[model samples]
Target: MLTSLYVRHFAVVEEAEIGFGPGMTVVSGETGAGKSLLVDALLLLSGARADSGMVRAGCERAELAAEFDLSALPEAREWLRQEALDEDETCRLRRVIRSEGSSRAWINGRPASLAQLGELAGRLIEIHGQHEHQALLSRSHQLALLDAYAGHAELVQRVRRLAQEGRALETQIRALQGEEDHASHLALRRHELTELERWALAPDALAELEARQRRLANAGRLAEGIAHLGELLDGEGELALRRTLARAQGELTRLVALDARLEPWRELIDGAAIAVDEAADALRRYLDEVDLDPARLAEAEEHLARLHELARRHRRPVDELGERANELRTELEALEQALAGLDARLAERDRLRRDYALAAAELGASRRAAAARLAADVSALMAELGMPGGRFEVMLETHGEDTSLDLLGRERCEFLVSANPGQPPRPLRKVASGGELARISLAIEVATLGKDSVGTMVFDEVDSGIGGAVAEVVGQKLRALGSRRQVLCVTHLPQVAAQGHTHLKVSKENVGGQTRTVITRLDEAGRAEELARMLGGLEITAETRAHARQMLERAQAD
Candidate 1:
């Protein structure tokens, strides 16, 4: 429900705030008193189009802001949650329209697009008038209302899920069908992978063999270095030292006499001779261990080349050749099974389409049944609203030849009405009289309000054409409707205005050469004056005031 509406610099309303409560609320005013201005601002807040001409003459821009208490409206909360915009259990819709025709929207303090604001506000309020009641006359809207009346949301949801699944299946089938002419293309790709599949490659075989090849290519230098080292350590210096030491030892016997240092020199030469023999033995062992093989190295290099070439062609690492082979083999198996799987999927799609047709047909039958009840209830209300024998018809036409797939369950529907008794029933849009049409439309709306998500219903001058008892009946009905939903009525009739749980009167005044609109909530005494003014026009007679007081007392008694 709307908590308050604030309009700043909009039309004749420089700044105004209107608070609303539940049950029937009536707004009464003299002509050109800005009651319609209040309604217009609300319409903009509800996502209606804005006009630059309505901006206050001196203001650069006009701002329209409306606050709604949505804690009780779970559907709206859920919608906001889905859109990720629910904040503080309250929805604040604001719009800024520049005098240059630029407009902007905000939801919950976040800047939003006008389209988004419109969608969000659509779930909040519904304004019904003689001009906008044509929405209930829309055939598609009527079908939705009928479905809602039938309480078949679960059934419709099931159908919706089925329809969604059927669409997905159809898309998959078409994608597979598009691939039907690609068998030759697939075959070529398979052959390419198969060519690269037959390779016997081992890792690092090339690098290891090349290292061994280099060693073999330098075998002569290694052999020469070994021989030269053996000659220097054994034959040249170590052997000569051993022979000289033995000679010195033999001479030392006669000169043991000369010094003990001579004896130490002989012992050192003996150690050197042992070292020379050990070095020559190690060199002989080293020469015996080197075996070079060029042919084996060549074979490794050739195999490495084949693996590298295959890897490059496939854009893979050389070590990944084995993995590539396995992948290609698996893909070949899948290709062999593709035809069977595609056939099964296509068959399943057809089966779901048949199931969808059956379920949707049942739903369509249920909607038709519900539509009849709706028309009867609305037709009854039309009679009570002073349009006796008004004919309200719900027409459902089946479209397309019988087929598995269809457009919107293949049903085209229309809601038709005739306002007068014995008058040929015609399309509602063809009606000429405003008040009769307004009543007929409201009757249908009240009947279908249960199916509609509109939390607030505003009726502008719907009680225009009738008076007295008829006016009382209209007020009673509007009041009765208040038990189920919020209703705002703009009226001049005392009985109608007196029907409200809260009444507000709009009046105009001239202050400093400018006309301004003022809205005041009527207290007990003020209520009598306002009601008296409504009953007796500009002059409030004593009798009229007394009558107004009595009317207020009677209204309160109810």
Candidate 2:
């Protein structure tokens, strides 16, 4: 339920904050008083398009905000939770349009895109008018409404799932016959798998083999390096650390006998000499093992080349050759198995097709039954809403020749209508006048009460061409609808305004040479005065006031 609306600098309305309660709220005023501005403000808050034209004159931007109580709207609450926009049990929608034609929106005080705002607003409100967002203008919405009436949700879901599965199977069958069935492709795949199997590659085999190859390639360089290291450590060279360290240790030992303070220096030189000898011995052993073998080097090079060629052929790096081989092997095995079970796969596909056909048939049957009821109910309501002898039909056209799968069942739906007797029903969109469309839309909405999940419904002058007794009937229907869900009606008929649980009168006033719109909520006495004005027009008489009072009393009694 929408709880409040605040509008600032919107069109001719400078500022207005209107509070609404649940049930029927009637907005009425004289012609050209901007009664529809309230509805427009709600639409903007519901994510309708905004432009500089909506901004008030002398104002930089127009701001509109609405608050909805979600306590009774579990679906809305859950939606907020899913979108991470929940603010307790309330939902706030705000929109701003600048004079430069820039527009922005926010949901729950968090910046939101137009799409998000529209999505949330769709679930929150449904506006019926000559505009595009009206659900009655959409054939898909008609079909959905009929399906909801028939409780076909589960059946429809099953059919949709079956159709999706059929599409996936069709794709797989095409691949099997088109791409994977080629003899040349299969032969190449087989050869690759055989080569990989023969090599039996391991994850780290390439790295290990390459390291061994490097060692064999540089065997001579390694031997020379080892020999030079040994010469530097102990050979008969001036830089031989072992020979020099031995001479230094002998001199230090003689000095220590002369001066006991040099004993520590002698010990340090002896340790250095021993360490050099040990290093030279280790180097000699390493040189002995550095033997060059061309056979081994060639073998490592050939193995590394084989790995590289396979990697390039498979469009992978040498390090990932093992993983690629495993993947190819798995795919080849699966393809071979699939070929063996080709007949079985075909049989399974046939079974799935049969299942899908069965589900679609069930769904179609339910829809046809529901369509009958919907047509009957809407036609009956149309007669009461001033469309006497009007006929409404829910036409279901089946696609019997369609062989391909579709998620929306195997039929199309159209809402056909005829406003006069002896005329065949035509598509609802073909109806010429806006008045007839509004009435038809009203009948459908009234008949489908509790079928829609939207919390609020707005009717923009739907009673335009209606008055007298028919206007009274329209008011009763709206009141009944309001009893079920929140309803806001912009009406000029006194009868409709009298039926509202709450009434607001829109009036235009000039202030400082500027025309501005204002909305005033009417109390009991105020309601009677407004109703009198509506009934008597520009003149208010004592008799008109008495009649207005009687009308309100009678309406309340009902």
Candidate 3:
């Protein structure tokens, strides 16, 4: 239930705080008194779009806040707790709109996104706008209303889940078959896989083969270079580097015995001779191992060339050939598996379709039963709400009976209404007048009241174009609804105003130099006067006051 609303610098209202109670609260005001502005502020707190124009002319921003008691709204409280926005047992929704058209929202004083505010608002309040009859005309909302009234929410959810599961399976099977349908495309991949398999490729094998080929190709030149190097270093030749270094070292050692500086030169000559001898030994071993075999070299070259050709054919680098081979093999294995399982997948799809069909049939039957009960119940309430000869019906249109699967089952639900005895039932939108539409909407809501999670219901001018005894009945119905849940109705009818447990009057006046709208809760005497004003128009005569007091007495007696 809404506890209070605080508004500041919004539209024509400078500042006002209105308090509300549990049962029916009716807001009534003269024309052009900005009563709708209060509704607009509530809408903003409920995540409606903010308009810069709503800000007062002298103010930079407009601020609106609403407090709701969550004791009876467990779902809303749970939402607040989950979002970490709870504040004891109350939920505070605040919205601020800047003159520049930007806006911000807060839930229980915690910053919130507009979507979060919207979600919480939806769970907490159900606003039946003056134009809400348009929603009654919507097929989806009509179906929802019937389902809600018949307690078919759980069953509908089950059917939706089954349908979703079936669709997922069908999509998977289609994707696999889509791949299988391109058999010709898979043919090239098959050839690539076969070529890679024929070589038995490994990542390092190609490089190793290339290295061997290089060694074989240069074998003769390598042997000659090593022999010549050996001769220069230590072989029996006049220019032997090791022999010359040894003689130099012996002379330097003898000189070092005479002078210390000669010792450093002796060390240098000795190191040079040692390095030359090591090189000559290594060269001799290499010369002995070197082999010039044309046949082995040709075979290595041919193997490397074949690997390179495969790389080119696959448009891959030579080193990546082995990796490419593995990828091709994996893909080909998957395709083979898919082909093998095609028949099994088809069988499974058929099974899933059958499952879906069974669930949908059950759901349809439940809806049919629920629809009948819903039409009967709403039609029964219609007469009391001011539509005496009205009839309500639920028309179900079925589709996809011959197809494989469907999402919202096979039926489409629409609401049909006959407002007069001689006329046939037509779509609700086409047959009901504005006043009749509001009454029908009221009946439907009353039928499905407790089934809805929303704790607070707002009716904006629902009594429009209605008066006299019908208005009194509307007031009674609203008061009854309010007994179970919070109801806020905006009306100009004194009958409805007289029924409120709490009455608020909206009025406009010139304050200081500015025109401002103000709302005040009225006492019993004040309520009588307000109702008298509503009844007598321009002047409240003694008889009008007496009638207003008697009306209140009669309403209380009922």
What are the lDDT scores of the predictions, listed in order? Answer: 0.76, 0.86, 0.82
The parts of candidate 2 lying over 4 Å away from their true place are: 57-61, 69-90, 108-111, 168-208, 254-266, 321-345, 388-390, 400-402, 420-426, 430-432, 509-516
Q: lDDT for model 2, please.
A: 0.86
- Candidates 1 and 3: which is better by TM-score? 1
Can you write out model 3's per-residue Cα lDDT over 1-558, one digit (the tens) per residue? 889899999999999998888888989999989877777887888777777899999899999999999888888989888988888888899999999999999998889998998889877877775554244677876776666776767777777877787788677678777764557757988887777776645667766877788899999889988888888888787668987887788788888888887777788888888888788888888888897888998888877788789988888887787789889888888877877787887887787777777778887898899888888888888877777887988999897664546667788888888766677888876753666666777777776664666778887887877789889988988888888888888889999988998888999999788999989888899999998999997777999999999998787677
Error of 3 at 287 (Å): 9.4
TM-score of 1: 0.72
User: Best-fitting candidate, measured by lDDT?
Assistant: 2
Candidate 2 lDDT tens digits, 292-344: 99999998888878877787788887777667778988888887787777677
lDDT of 2 at 379: 96
Q: When superposed on Cα atoms, how far off is each prediction in RMSD?
A: 10.1, 3.7, 6.0
- In model 3, pairs of residues that clash are none
**Which residue pairs clash in candidate 2?**
none
The per-residue C-alpha lDDT of model 1 at residue 37 equals 75
